[model samples]
Target: MLKKSLISVLCLSLLVPAVSLAETATHAVKPLTAHQERMKTCNADAKGKKGEERKAFMKSCLKGESAAAVKKAPEAKKHEKKTAKKPKTYKKLNSQQMRMKTCNVEAKGKKGAERKAFMKSCLSNK
Candidate 1:
């Protein structure tokens, strides 16, 4: 009787795991929802795009909005304008240019000779 009960317990434990695994497998193969399908398609379509282009594509695709609509949207236009306005970077100054800039600031109100003397001292000190 004990041997029969032990064998039954073992079989039950094995069966429980097999049944759970089968359930999980069925659920794992679930069909994609409409939104998920659209996202997948859009991601595939956006493979070649990058940066703002990819961002805009994904945003419009997920929202079910058209590309033209995204382009015409005020917020999207603002984003484009903001991205367009990159900060200007000045060219690096050489030693003479750098010294001149410093001396000019320091000698802002000084007259010719005084400015010349201050500039000479500043440039020499550097």
Candidate 2:
């Protein structure tokens, strides 16, 4: 009976530490909330700033009023204007035009049958 109790106690001692360690590991790995993440970002951005500058930056950042946020409004407007402008559409060349352009490039030095054969094959491939 005494030996059994001792063995049980030993097993419990090992199990208790393992359970506590797991609990601690889980708690330690808990993800930060949105607010916490924003704060961390603001803190990093405020690294070079100090005193009133840091305080003001943190306040504006936390309030979502930083320069990036303000600049985005104008940038978004510019983007809208750019997108509002119609894109230029180009007319595709016809098969004859494409063949002429390719033949002109390929037949730069050649003449007679070679140029004719190249032009024929080039036009045929298309």
Candidate 3:
């Protein structure tokens, strides 16, 4: 009984996808026509211009007239002057400098095991 039930379930799963695919194959998709493409171009052009310039440009474009009638003004200023000072750069420690620093820190009265533990803790903290 369990074998028959499992076979039926497997058959149903296979049939469902086949039926959906067959239905989709018979349907047709419509593409966007020339008029829609022209309107998309006009909308893109009007989006960058502001207020009166935008309105005048859209009106002239829509009426099939040239863009000469639209008076284009200078773009509005959007950026602010940064008054903050630039951060200072320091020279990086070379391999020799790093070794000297490690030796100096270890020499400040720490024994071998304590020095190892301190170095491990410093690296892990970083």
| Top candidate, metric lDDT | 1
TM-score for all models, in order of appearance: 0.45, 0.44, 0.32
lDDT of 1 by residue, 7-83 (tens): 99999999999999999999999999998899899899778777776787788878988878855555666677878
Give per-residue CA lDDT, model 2, range 28-47, as digits (tens): 99999999998998898778
Ten-residue region with minimum lDDT total, candidate 3: 72-81
Ranking by lDDT: 1, 2, 3
Provide the lowest-lDDT 10-residue window in model 1. 70-79
Local error of candidate 1 at residue 6 (angstroms): 3.5
Q: Which of the two, 2 or 3, has more lDDT?
A: 2
Report the error of model 1 at residue 30, Å: 3.5
Using TM-score, give the best candidate's number.
1
Q: Which portions of model 1 miss their true places by more than 4 Å?
A: 65-126
Per-residue lDDT for 44-122 in model 3, tens only?
Answer: 9788787766766766676666555443321221122244456899899987668667766765787799877776665
What RMSD value applies to candidate 1?
A: 9.9
lDDT score at residue 5, model 1, on the 0-100 scale: 100
Q: State model 2's lDDT.
A: 0.80
| Regions of model 2 farther than 4 Å from truth | 68-126
Q: In model 3, how large is the Cα lDDT of residue 89? A: 94
Select the stronger candidate by TM-score from 1 and 3.
Answer: 1
